[model samples]
Target: MNRTELRFALHLIGFLDSVEGFEDGMVKLRDRRWLVWHPDVMAALFRHDRDLRHPPSRTLSPLLGNRSVLWLDGEEHAKYRRTLAPMLRGTRYQALIDEMVERSIAELPSGPVGLAEWTRRLTLRITGRILFGVDDEELLAAFTRWLDRRLGSRVRTLAHRYLTPGTTRFDPELDRMLLHRAETAEPPALAAFLPPEDLRDQVVSLLFAGHETTASATAWTVYWIDRTPGLAQDLLGDADLLEATIRESLRLSPPATLAGNRMSADGMVITPSIYLAHRRAATYDHPHTFDPTRSPPPPGAFFPFGGGVRHCLGKDLALTEIRTIVTALLRHRRIHLNTQRSCTPQLRGAAMAPPPSLAMVATCRR
Candidate 1:
């Protein structure tokens, strides 16, 4: 079969996603892991993925290597996930969607502005309100600045080499707590969850990865849906169709372009390529095309949040946030791409971001 055409067809059918699919793809990049069976192998990869600590594997998805659990495998991964479980349940996250997100988006400045940058703001606000219970505007801006510095600089790459295990670095938590506690009182402060150094990293990862990544996915989805007039009509015409559109969009531009990485210390056939498998299952059609009106595949076909035990911890939160924001946008405002729009990819550490210049505008309902 002609793989290229097949890739194109999948996009036409909405089977493969472009933005994030490349992140998980094996055909192009080197040193990556993709979950094929998803419900099976992706789970297996995450379950045994901790081998990174031993060496050879070093770090999987080095772009997101700082996440604490990325180095843990098997029972260890489970233990950490268990502790984090209560905080990220689907239902609890869904609750935050309704009460907090709408008001925040409603407050944005209107008229031909770049929604790409704003999408990041929208993700951060929901995460701040729901998880940290703090929304100090200035502190949030500071953390965003620090995060941008860390991700968009070469010093971090140097730290990966020079700052091994014992070397100290400025704590990532100091800013968020200051931002939250300094501003609000209702849920009180998070004087408790701040200590365990490693837990702090998780919070940082949650903010950076949680909101930024989801916002990228959400922004692209909104843009493409608007580009495809028929698909936008489909979503506006049917609620069930909304979920399908989101699923297809996620398949196209995944937040993390790459999936998990694995190494085998034992006799295990540890094939380090989750992104490839993700691209494989969704193979066919212009894999890069952004077509929302596609057919749904069987479970585990598109491995974005990953597969198995090592799946993303904040997936439910991200989904709730995206759905809430998208659904809300669809409900009130009509979004249109400005004809003179321009955006360039900015490198932020391991993440890829559209330049800060990326801009769009939406109209408020009458």
Candidate 2:
């Protein structure tokens, strides 16, 4: 990691003991001025008075699309969120678990396999089916390529979004597929409020968010579980332990490490660091340790999917997918990390993914 990235990681992991005493819980970085890491203050910033602040749309618009719910705030954000909420509810999420399990089982290799890569592919397939209603191999391949290119760099993504013609429009066949699925599947009520363009952008945004973050979380969960002997069996036997395992994995290594930068209407900048907040000693005992049995961090302190009104719309879907993947894996196989080398976190695009070389060996459980 570069110096800046290393510093950020240290902050996120609570290794920087010196930061525990910044005045008002604010630290200045570069010329941008204030960076807030305190859990309580950051939580309040997210939960209260959201109307006065908005995410950094200028930076994200190119990738998420200008009309995406991620870029909207206040009444506009609420309107879209309400329309999309039903599709991500527990029942809807539960309905997708069987398919998730099937996919994970089908994709698992016989020996050692890169857990992160496999999970990314698994999540991409799952989200592709859910969002587009079809899992055409060619379509998924194309989407993965596009996502890889766009997420590689912010400058390049902006250039591509602006310079490339028809970049804002969904593929014709994919759009038709989604529309057809909407006829039978539970679709978001976006058409009532948004134009076709905005609706398309919203669907695309959801697909990106749903696939990437869940993949990272699932990989990390598997990595941690594999590291601890008997934990996988414990997770399979106890439902609460399974839930705690997922929560602790997210707390330790949230995919979306930082919340989108929020700029106040009055020209003040409020940077909400989900990573740092998760590591805050005040919010968690032994913040760096991965203890599934630990009491859950209080509400706002552990926000892997973020907080407040703009919290990830796919939070339920992501959690369900992670639970389903982990449960299925454990039930079918005993998971162990390849002990030849240590696994670490690596920044991939917008998420902190498991190291590319990190592999898990899964043996069929008798």
Q: Tens digit of lDDT per residue, candidate 2, span 151-213?
A: 544345445544573445345675555444434444434444456667667766777787888
Candidate 1's TM-score: 0.72
- RMSD (Cα, Å) of model 1: 7.2
Q: What lDDT does candidate 2 reach at residue 246?
A: 89
Clashes of each: 36, 0
Report clash pairs, candidate 2. none
Query: Per-residue alpha-carbon lDDT of model 1 for 1-366, expressed as tens digits?
Result: 255434422231122234235434323222232223333445445555555432222221233334456556667567767776666655776766776667866776776666667887778877666556756676568766765544543355345423563343444465446444523545533334334445545555556666777777788678667767567556765767777777777775555544444446643233323233434434435554665566655454576676555567888877777777788787777777663333334434323345555566667767
lDDT of candidates 1 onward, in order: 0.56, 0.70
Candidate 2 ranges beyond 4 A from true positions:
1-24, 30-33, 57-59, 152-194, 339-342
